[model samples]
Target: MARIQTMRVDRMLSSMGYGSRSEVTRMGKAGIITLDAAEIADAARRIAVTPDLPARMKIDGEALDPLTGVVILLNKPLGMTCSHKDSGVLIYTVLPDRWRRRTPVIATVGRLDKQTSGLILLTDDGDLLHRIISPRSRVRKTYRATLARPLAGNETELFASGELMLDGDAKPLAPAELSVVSETEAIISVTEGRYHQVRRMFAAAGNHVTELHRERLGGLSIPDGMASGQWALLEADNIASIFHMDPAKQT
Candidate 1:
């Protein structure tokens, strides 16, 4: 004999955020839930549950479902916020409408200020996001900064020794690689992520950063061909390389 299964429908709906348990119970009592036009007798009745997309449970004709998750990298353009809320102008607005409709929700793993432009990772993969972002994971991020004034004095040594102070904070920043590629341009690499770190470091060094662009994260370098405001899907090898393991070394 097949084993009988049972659960309160309202409880399941509540768990999924369809409504509060009390509210769902009221909806059922008010003759809202129906399959093929027959009203469900009890909100507590056992019912089979199945996953469906593009279809959802209805409450007085209002449909609802949990957002599905996805991972994406956006070459975030200037003047867009990473947040999901309708923040006037946002990065998601630039994406094709179909991508915006995906479930789970995609978020920019690390953020770039509205005026600071470059590659930004957006994803719903919790484990992968953690691996790429955890401070203990020691993932390195590289940025190309253009300064309003050329760097001079003890800036190079200060950056090399990681002795630059970022203001009221008593402790110094982690060791970082700072090198000048030109008189007015330089590259800064650091593992510790702090609020406005690159710009602040340059400011601390007595050189004001005029423009900031992130060029690399972990082992993945920004593709030379990709331009601002455009994005590409990362391949498996790209994801694997972020952990410092050579993708080619794997069998």
Candidate 2:
């Protein structure tokens, strides 16, 4: 029931990080915001700051918080949708209940096409999410891709020299590393995460990717024994390593 006085409900909820201003306003006007037994009819209702405002606040009978954040990782499995719809199975539905109850809301840092499977970070910390995902940060991610062709001498050098195209786009990507793991499999590392980047990059090189699995992010990797569809709480040290900083220095 946390509450803050404001001229508009959208403004208040947006400031609290629930979502964009327009989204909150739409919810408010739809009779989603309520107090006691009465629906909050106006999107611009003035009120005093009170914890009770958000306390037990339910949209479609689901409690929500306007000012909290969450950070967690999910080993996304293929064939599952990443959306919030209830029809098809989603990544969040597979998470243990204990990890689902966090303040504000957490969204996948980036995206993995429904066919792709691997470590996906979900967080509500906007700054941290942006820092780790932004191309400007040069955060590298490694992937093991099963391809249709074997990469040899010149192929690896070409990949590392940024000499590949992305579909119709003429711009070459930043330098990436490619190591042939098998006749039809390779490990690739790239810092620029364009849409369908890995799959398209391989396709551009006269190969097709049959499967793409992310193994590392920001120089940190998932530990052994962490099964697919399982998640674990990240430690403070884990966050520090992404920046190459010791936790002690951060404090």
Candidate 3:
């Protein structure tokens, strides 16, 4: 038979942000932790940490939060900072408070500025987070901008030229796509995640962006009926779609 995987019950709970080692021991003594319907009175005891651990364990009459990798898609709201330690209301506050206490910590895959609102991914999986944010991924991020002025007509060519340079940047941006929805609104898609790139691009074109909202990232788009600050805890398979570009989203 293959070797069995296991971990200290207290360590699992504490790492998941349930509590500290001593606190877990107290929880065990209080009959608050259980495995497979049996009371786990010794938090120090090692238990099998399997794919089914979440279903097998209960804490305070609730199933354990997904232990290993947790991913969530949030419709980031305006005026909210993504940093965990940022003062006042933060994007982290919209998620479970216990999530912030997790060992590896849940962090945004890439930042969206405080004034910008749109699709943002947060995950506890370090590798997955890095993969998404890496420039080599070439994942397309689409932003719909409301402009203060009407179309200049040449913006489409300028962005698609693949030679547009933002101030202070040493390299030209990769080819980007621009779609005009109307005289004062346009959608721009880019593979780069440069700082304030979309707004800067508009400024370079001599237009002011009155509002900016990300519509999609790769294949992930904010689902209908989801309000600002709303989020969906994603399944394992759903994570793959983050790397798959949807051709239909180009429209």
Cα lDDT tens digits, model 1, 133-214, are 8898888788889999977856768887967689977789988887778989998888988889889998888889888888
Best to worst by TM-score, what's the order? 3, 1, 2
TM agreement with the true structure for every prediction: 0.68, 0.66, 0.95
Off by over 4 Å in 3: 1-4, 249-251
Which TM-score value belongs to model 1?
Answer: 0.68
lDDT of 2 by residue, 1-251 (tens): 65555446566656555566777778777887776656776766765545455564565455545334446777778876666664667777775443344334566778777888887887768888888888777877778899766764466887888667777786988888787888888888888889899988777778788999888776567768888788765656776566552222235
lDDT of 3 by residue, 16-53 (tens): 89989999999999999988899999999998888888
- Global lDDT of each candidate: 0.72, 0.71, 0.90
What's the lDDT of the predicted structure labeled candidate 1? 0.72
Q: Which of 1 and 2 is the better model by TM-score?
A: 1
Q: Which candidate do you rate higher for lDDT, 1 or 3?
A: 3
Name model 2 segments beyond 4 Å from true: 1-67, 85-87, 96-103, 245-251
